[model samples]
Target: MVVGLGPGSPDWTTPEVREALNAATDLVGYTTYIDRVPPRPGQHRHASDNRVESERAAMALDLAKRGARVVVVSSGDPGVFAMAAAVLEESADPQWQDVPVRVLPGLTAANAVASRVGAPLGHDYAMISLSDRLKPWEVVAQRLSAVAAADMAIAIYNPASSQRTWQVGAMRDLLLEHRKPDTPVVLGRDVGGPTESVRVVSLVDLDPADVDMRTLLIIGASTTAAVDTPTGTRVYTSRRYHRR
Candidate 1:
């Protein structure tokens, strides 16, 4: 079963998701996401290194081929920018073709970050992965520029890592081309677990040095504005508003 974990908060975990996790004989996921699941005895675990989708998919397929009821977990909804794509792409392997593959939906990192930053995604928005580790940086830059030109709030995933540091800055510069310097930016790290961190900043204040693999950046659109109220100064991307 694939579980959509609804971000990293414990209460965000759905009852059915917990039951599925408990029922599984084996768990397979990226090391970071796998670590968030509470440790349960008697379940075998196979953790994958970063960016090893093919290997993880093959391993999970192997266990499932042997008739083990394995749970392939993705942090958010399995289908969103996560392992579900890897699993499906690799499922073409002859031995794995007919195996039953179930996908359980979890809250995506985008939704998690969006919630913390008000309704920035309340209107049409785009989610892009700035990590060019797998895709060409030029392609990523083009998309960034396009999204900026179109004025959509963009949820950027995998912004930077030890080896992929420059892309985030490049994305920032690209967005800056069509966006004002003060656009609201939301940075989320470890969204649902004990170590989670969420920060709201402006585009001009975003320091690329602060990013790591665990962080996600949400860049609000031109119409997105900060409002001062008794609760505090809040930034919102209005669902009731859009620009042509």
Candidate 2:
């Protein structure tokens, strides 16, 4: 089974996922995600580096074949840039074909971040990862340009990290080509966790230095708007579109 922990918050974790965790005899995941779950009396954890997803999936399958109720835990919804795909890919192996796999949904980071604000994703949106480790930067740039030209809101994941920092600034520049300078961009860092911070800025004002691996960016479309209320500033994209 694959379980989602939901953006590092216990409150965000689903009841079904919690039940699966409790029932699991073994847990397999990236070290950080595995550490997020409190250690149980008898549950064995197989934690690995985040880069070694294929090996981690194989480990889970091996344990499951040996009569262990294994659960692979991911930070957000496993189906969205998480372990579910990795596990499924590994399960295609002839050796693990007989092992049954199941996935449980959890709140995605994009949705969690959008909720913190008003509803930046209320209308049509596209989710893209800026990571070039697996794919070339050209492909990432092509997708970003296509989405920007389509006037669709964007939920950007893996914008930057210690080793990869230029993508965010480049992304901002590319979006500027199609989106207005004043387009709303929400920066959510460590959202739902103890160090959570969410702020709204214009596309031109988005600083690459402010982003990291823990950050998720929501770049709104032309129909998106930010307004101040008695409570705080709320950002949302209009559901009703005006033909341009």
Candidate 3:
């Protein structure tokens, strides 16, 4: 079973996922995700680096084959750029053909972040990962350009990290070619975590230095609007599109 733990908060974790974790005899996942689950008696955890997803999937399958009740944990929805795909890919192998797989959904980072800042994704939107580790930079750039030209809201994941720091700025530049400089951009960092912060800025003011792997960016469409409420500012894309 592959379960999503939601976005770094116990309140965000679903009861179904909690039940699966309690029933699991062994847990296999990235070290950071594994550490999120409190240790319990008789349950064994096999944690590894984040980059070894294939190996981790195989390890979970091997454990399940040996009569262990294995659960693979991931942050956010497991099917959304998370462990579900990796496990399903590994399960296609003839060696693990008989192993049964189940995926449990949880609140995705995009939805969690959007909720914190009203409905920036109220209309058509695209979700893209800025990381080039698995795919080439050219492909990433092409997708960004296409989405921008289509005038759809965008949810960007894996924007930057210690090793990768330039992609966000490049994205902002490419987006400017198709979008307005005053386009609303929402930055959500560690949403649901203790140090959580959600703020809005213009596209031209989006600095790469402010983003990290933990940050999720929402770039609004041409129809998106930002209104200053009594409590705070709320951003949302218009549900009705105007005829061009």
Q: Per-candidate TM vs. native?
A: 0.92, 0.98, 0.97
CA lDDT of each prediction against the hidden true structure: 0.81, 0.94, 0.94
Whole-structure CA lDDT of model 3: 0.94
Q: List residue ranges in candidate 3 displaced over 4 A.
A: none
Cα displacement (Å) at residue 153, model 1? 0.7
lDDT sort, best first: 3, 2, 1
How well is each residue in 155-208 modelled by candidate 2, as lDDT tens digits?
999999999999999999999999999999999999988899999999999999
Reference-based lDDT, residue 210, model 2: 95
What digit string (tens of lDDT, one per residue) describes model 3 on residues 1-244?
9999999798999999999999999999989889999998999999888557899899999999999999999999999889899999999999998899999999999999998889999999999999999999999999999999999999999999999999999999999999999999999999988899999999999999999999999999999998889878899887999855
Instruction: Flag clash pairs in model 3.
Output: none
lDDT tens digits, residues 1-244, model 1?
A: 5666767786777788788888899999877667877888888888777658888888888898898988888777788778788887888878787777777777788887777657778877988888776789889888888888888889998898888888777787778889899888988898767788877788988899988988989888988887767765566787776545
Comparison by lDDT, 1 against 2, better one: 2
Best candidate, lDDT: 3
Q: 60, model 3: CA deviation in Å?
A: 0.6
